[model samples]
Structures are given as C-alpha cells and as structure tokens.
Target: MSLKSLGAKIFAKIVFNRIQKWATNPVETQQKVFEKLISEAKNTVLGKDHDFENITSFEDFAAKVPIRDYEELKPYVERVVSGEENILWPGKPLYFAKTSGTTSGAKYIPLTKESMPHHIEAARNAILCYIKETGKADFVDGKMIFLQGSPEMQEKNGIKVGRLSGIVAHYVPAYLQKNRLPSWETNCIEDWETKVDAIVEETKNENMSVISGIPSWVQMYFERLQKSSGKKVGDLFKNFNLFIYGGVNFEPYRAKFENLIGRKVDSIELFPASEGFFAFQDSQKEKGMLLLLNSGIFYEFVEATTFFDKNPKRLTIGEVEIGVNYVMIISTNAGLWAYNLGDTVQFTSTKPYRVIVSGRIKHFISAFGEHVIGKEVEEAMNKAISKFNFSITEFTVAPQITPSEENLPYHEWLVEFDNSPENLQKIAEFLDLEMQQQNSYYFDLIEGKVLQPLKITSLKKDSFQEFMKSEGKLGGQNKVPRLSNDRKIAVALIQIQPQN
Candidate 1:
C-alpha cells in the first residue's frame, strides 16, 4: 500500500473502533442525543412552540411535538427563510438545502453548523468502515467523481442555498480534492445534458477509481462513456472498484449496471436526505445500513400500516423490533422537530439498529387491500430478472382498477427494457409469482381472483427518460418512483411516448 492508503487504513481503524462503541450501546447513545437536541433547542421558536422546556421523556416529547411533514412545518421554515434568528435552531442557518417537495413546492431545509458534521462524517466513516473491513484503500490514490447537481449557489436571505448535493460539492474534504474528477466548470454547467456531456469529455481518459451518485443518473453517464470510448466502463476505469449510491433502491438497476461496467464493484449504500444523513452500509457482509444513533438526529418510528391512523404510536430506539416496517420520523439538530420525512424503513437488525428503506409512506398501492410496497416490487422485479436474465432499463407498477370486462383489474407494469424479453408473458408470470411469494395479501388477491396476474407493457426505449424530461427532472437528484398508488405517473408516461 502507498503512504496515503496506509494512513487511511490506520484512520479507518480508529473510526471503526469508535463506531463499535455505539453499535453495542445503540439505545443509550440515542437517548443521549435526544436529551441534547431537546436541551439545546429549548429556547428556539419551534422548541418554545412545542413546549420543549417541559418535555422530559420520549412520551412527553411525542405528546407535545406532533409529527409534522413539510407543509405543517412550513410556517416556521418560512420564518427562518425570511432571516429570522433562533426560529428553529439557536440562530440563522449556515445554508438552506433547497429541495423539491410533494405537497409544498420547494422545501428549504436548514443546515446548521452543529448538524453539518453528521452528514459529512457519516459518509466518510462509511468508506473508513469499508477500508477497515477489506484492507482496500488503494482507490484513494486514483481519481474519484461524483455525478451530482451544480455546485453553484443562490443566496436566500443572506444564507447560501442550493441542492443538497450541490451544497455538498463545495465541501469535498481537502485530502480527496486532488483525486476528485470532473472540473468545477464541468460541474457548474446547470443543464443536465450539457453537464453530462462536459463530464464525459473531461473524465473519459482519467484514472477513475470511485464513482458515486444515484443509480439512474450514473447509468446515463456510463452509457455516455461507453459510447464515447467504445469500451465498457470497467475496462476504461480499470481501477474503479467502489460504487456509492443513495436515494433509490439499487437492486433493480444492478443488472443493467453490471452490464454497463462489465464487472461487479463493491457498493456502499447511504440513507441521506435534506433533513439529515441517517445511516450507511458499514459492513460488506451486513444486510442493512447501520443507523447513526449518536448523530444529531433523534429518531422515532411509527408503524407504516398505522401511519395514517388517528394518533399513531411512535416507537423509540428501545421499542423497535426487527422486520417491522416503520415510517421514520426524526428530530434533528437542523431544528426539524418531530419531522416526518415520508420515507418508510424496516428494521433489519435491532442489535445495531440497522434499517432498510422499504418505501415511502405516501407511495404504495393499496387500491385492492393488497398493499404493495416499493421494496416488495423491487425484490420481485429482481427475482424475475434474475430468473430470465432479462435487461430492464427502468420500470414502475400501478393498479389497473378499471380494465376491460373480459379481464379482472390487475397491477400494470410499464417496463423500459434495454433488450426486450422474447417471452414477455412468461416474464410477467414470473414477476407475478415472485410478488405473490413476497406479499401474502397479493397472494390472496390472486387466489381469490380479485386481481388478475400483473400485466407487463414494454415501454419504448427512453420512455422513463422522456417522462422525467417532460417533468423537468431529467437528471440531478430526481428519480422516477418505483411504484405509485395512482396513475398520475403512468398517465404521464403514456402521454410521453408509445408503449408495446
């Protein structure tokens, strides 16, 4: 190993040891974090509004501060946006991470000085954990590139504002700056297509060892690289061994990525949002991400099934169980109190409190009482793909409630395939079988003839891309939802182009 790699290995050992402390004392660490968040923010606007001074226990905190999504939390966020000090946290934030919201248009999430370290450190330690486990830090000597939003900033009330990825681009640790690829000018190109073109030109011949981004966007870059160099991405960047991704489930895209790169690379999964960086895949052999209990965020879990019910019970770290799907609610140092981030997660390992993002609370199909989640569908899709060795570019599922009188209503799958399967009906049957195996309710629905086997509609090439482009979200952090309860996205896809 080189001097740098040796140094990284030593540093990785230190971080790994530190992380082990909380792995054993997960609940205790979280309780301490909870107390700190409450005590520190007791004087802030949200803290005062929620009677934080009187809050003593988790139950008290839950009772006083009701879980609020972006819309409910908007009034206070607006105050902070208008240059109000101590509105959420102790003072005005250092940055506002501008993100596209669902109910509200654009959400400006705070990034306080106190909270920023978690985001940065969690990501760093994830790599350190890998280095410690595998004894592979040679990638540190080579080029690294992150496919992300522009680094350009727009000021909002004296506070800097940009996409979270864009804001993070400005803070690439000093050590990695030398190894980081894609020049500042290339990253600053705002238009997605133009920026990608610039990135391809700049990094095509570079010694790239690490490539990180959302899967779909990175696929585009890989394709572009392949086209330009007439070689698989793996061949071009032979040293490229680490793939880091966040935002969406990577299982469905794994096959396509494997084909693009011509080989498999070790991957690290991250659970990060504008609110906070919650978890990261710490062990190569582990099933789920190791939740950051000692981070500035205090987490709560409401069972996803009862999330919409009147007064859903919130569970603390000690109260959680393995395999239970929960809507992850968080109160963070960023001053987001009892915030519902919309993402639903399942606890895979309670010992260290590891979680897998199952789906979004607002994004599931329950039209026929056979509630289907994103994780189930993605797993079923992967199963079917693996069985058939088929090439799927992108796909989504929605309920076909009103079908022709001849057929029962079913789940409609719109698939964009890189290489269309010869036996579409067989693949559909396989997908349906896998889905039934995964979800018992779906099994009942199929057995009772409440719904027919899922129907697959092969979409024209680039259908998903066209839909995203039409929605003004062709690139950056934007992603097509894997499953939608409604036909909004399906209808929009239909309007965009032809389907088979």
Candidate 2:
C-alpha cells in the first residue's frame, strides 16, 4: 500500500477502536457526545454570525428557526451560482451536487468545504464501524467497486463547473485514486446510457471485493453480466465478498441476489443523499442504526402523528421513542438550517438510534382517498409472501383507478418471484387480505366499491432489471421507484389486470 492508504488505514483503525469503546458504554454516554456536538455547532454558528448568538439549547435552536424545503433555497442557490459570496455561506460552495426533485426537474445543491468534510467523515465512519463490527477489514484487499454515478463536470456559459459527485471523486485520497475502477474524469453522469456499458466492460476483469450501489443498478449489472458471459451471477462474482447498497430499499431484490450469487452476501443500508452522507448501517446485526454525524449537522425529528399539523412537535435524539415514525429535519454546517428533507423514518430502537426508512412524504398513494405509504405496502407484501413460504425477488406498486362510475382506485403489484406459480392466486388473496388489515381506509374504499381489486403481475423472472435499464436509470444511486401514485403514468406502463 502507498503512504496515504497506509495512513488512512491507521487513522481508520484508531477511529474504529474509539467507536467500539463508545458503543459499549451506557446510552447516556452517546447522548452526552451528541449534546457536546450540538453545543459546538451552536457556538460555531454564533461565532460566524452575531444573529445566532441568542441560541442557547438544542430545543431553543430548533424552535427559533423555521423549517425550510429545497424550493425556499432556490434564490440563495442562484445567487451563489452567480459568484456571490456570503449568500448561503461565507464563501462560494466548493461544488453543487445535482439531485432530482420529485416535483421540480433537477436541483444543484451547494456543498461548501465545511460541508464536504461532514460527508467524507460520515462515509469513513460508516466503513470503520462496519469493519469494527464484522472484523472484515483484512478481507478487502481487492478493489472496492463503488458503482457510483459518473464524475463528469457540467459546463455552463464557457465555464466548467464540477458537480458534487465529480468534486468528491476528485478529492478522494490520492493513494486509492489510481485504484478506482473508472477514471473519475471520464465517468459522465449526463452520459449514463453510455457509461453504464463502459462500467460493465471495465470491471469485467477486475477482482472486485466490495460492490456498493443502489440495489436497482446492481441488479441490472448482475443481469447484464449473466447475459454477456453466458453464466450465472454466481459465476461472475464468485470472488466478491460484501455488497453494500444504499439510496433505496434492498428487501425486494434480496432473494434474487442471494440465489444468483449462491452465497449470503453481507449487505448494509446507507442513508445518504447528494446533500450529504447522513446515517449508515452502524451495526450488522441491528436494523440500520443512525450513527449521528455529531460533527456534521444537528438533527431534529418531527413526530409522525403531528407532522401534518401547523404546530408540530419536534424531538431531539434523546426525546425520540421506538416504533414511531418521524420527519427528519437538519441544520447542517453547509448553512441549511432546519431543512426538511421530505423523507420519513421510524426508529426501531432509541439507545443506538436504529431507524428504518418509512417513505418519502411526497411519494405516497392517495388513490380513492386511501393514503398508503411505502412502509405499509412493504409490510403488507412481506406478510403476504411469508404466508406462502416463498420470497419476493423484486416488486413495485402503482395506484390504479378505473374509469367506471365508481371511480375506484386500487393497487397494481408488479412482482418477480423465484418459486412455482402453483399458489399464485393464493398469494394474491393473502396480499389483498393483508392490505385490508393494515389499511382501514383501503378496506372501506374497496368494500364500498370506490376501489378495485388488487392486481399482481408475475414478471419473467429477471425482467425488472431489463425494464429499469431501458429507462436509462440503470446504475448506482437510481432504483425502481417502489410506489408511483400518479394514475396516468401508472396506466401507461404497468398492466393492471392480474396475470393467470
């Protein structure tokens, strides 16, 4: 290993050791660490601007600031892009991370030097914690294949501007820079259609140990590899060690991957975005634990019960409870104060802050006025599939409303399964029953004939990956949207009638 890699390895070891000690301590110790970090962040803000000096405690800080969404920051982003200093921060942000907004087309989120460190540190700490928990650091001798978005810089008006992906890739430790599979500068995000093919070609011969990306893209790559090599995914990735996936749900794709690889690959969920690398899989055994980047951003959780209310109550890490969903709000070092990221999560446990992503606030189905979020659908589906002793390989749900007088709305399930179809109808009946049990509103609407029956389409084994690839969203960071509420789009693509 080169000097920088050796230094990074040593630094990682020290950090991992410290985290291990911290992990074993009482819950109060972790809270104290969070408290100290919150105080430091408050102090830093106060020192930079006199306006923030009035902030006293975490609660005070949260109460005094109003929650902000991405739309509210557009003007400030525009000003920064125009080369203005001190609009959002003291200086121009290092680079803008390009992200797709659910409603808006695309957004360039600015990440300053102060903010970039947080992203880097969160990712590093996640890796270190994983290594500490699993004791598999020594096994990572082969190249770490981050099936990441392209690192191409976008040019506007004769000026070449780097996106956050490009910027982060540019700043990666110099030692491991040469070892990166695709040359950073050549991997263009705008050219994903072409780059994905190149990515498969480039990594075909390399001994890849750790493969990290969104489950959708990885699934696509696996499918392509299977076809191109005329071999199963197990043959192509026989030497692969661990699979670290993020950006979307992996539960649906889990069985297919495991079966294809012929080995139980160690998997972890990463809660990261273009904005910043936030929480990650803190422990392999526990459901995704939220390791608060104490140094990066101060976090607040709005109680799920009161999130839609005008005066919702916000809770800190200490005040949060298990089994309750909350909307995450953060005040980051990047100058975004009390920003609502639109995602929803539920805490599985509080001591270590284990959270499972519930769904995005905007990404829900309200067809026939029966509100259904991603989590509820997933749970219902899980229950239904478990009854048949068969596992779901991949699935997506879309709301469907027939044009009849009832104007009813129901769900269309596009599912891929590995087992025999002898009990397919039984599976559908169980799914419908589970939906009725979980969602009262859905039951009422369906019984009243205001909603149609739930429909299921059993795909041709490995067709979901093909469908995603055809859309040109076939790599890291992108995933098959689990739920689409829009009626027009749903009708055009997915077949509503249940297959025999």
lDDT of 2 by residue, 163-211 (tens): 4556666666655565566655447645655666677777777776677
- lDDT by residue (1-500, candidate 1, tens digit) is 89999999999999999999988998889889999999999999888988999999998998899999989989999999999999999989989999888866888999999988888899899999999999999999999999989899999889999998888888889999989978898889888988888899989999999999999999999999999999999999999999999999999899999999999999999998889999999989989999999889999999998998999999998999998889999999999999999999998998788999999988899999988999999998888888999877899999989888777999999999998889999999988999999899999999999999999988888898888888889899998998888899988887776433
> Candidate 1 — number of clashing residue pairs?
0
Off by over 4 Å in 1: none
The per-residue C-alpha lDDT of model 1 at residue 253 equals 91
Q: What TM-score fits each model? A: 0.98, 0.84
Worst 10 residues of 2 by lDDT: 42-51
Q: In candidate 2, residue 457 scores what lDDT?
A: 69
Largest TM-score belongs to which candidate? 1
Off by over 4 Å in 2: 1-13, 20-51, 155-163, 383-394, 403-408, 416-422, 443-453, 458-476, 495-500
| Per-residue lDDT of 177 in model 1 | 94
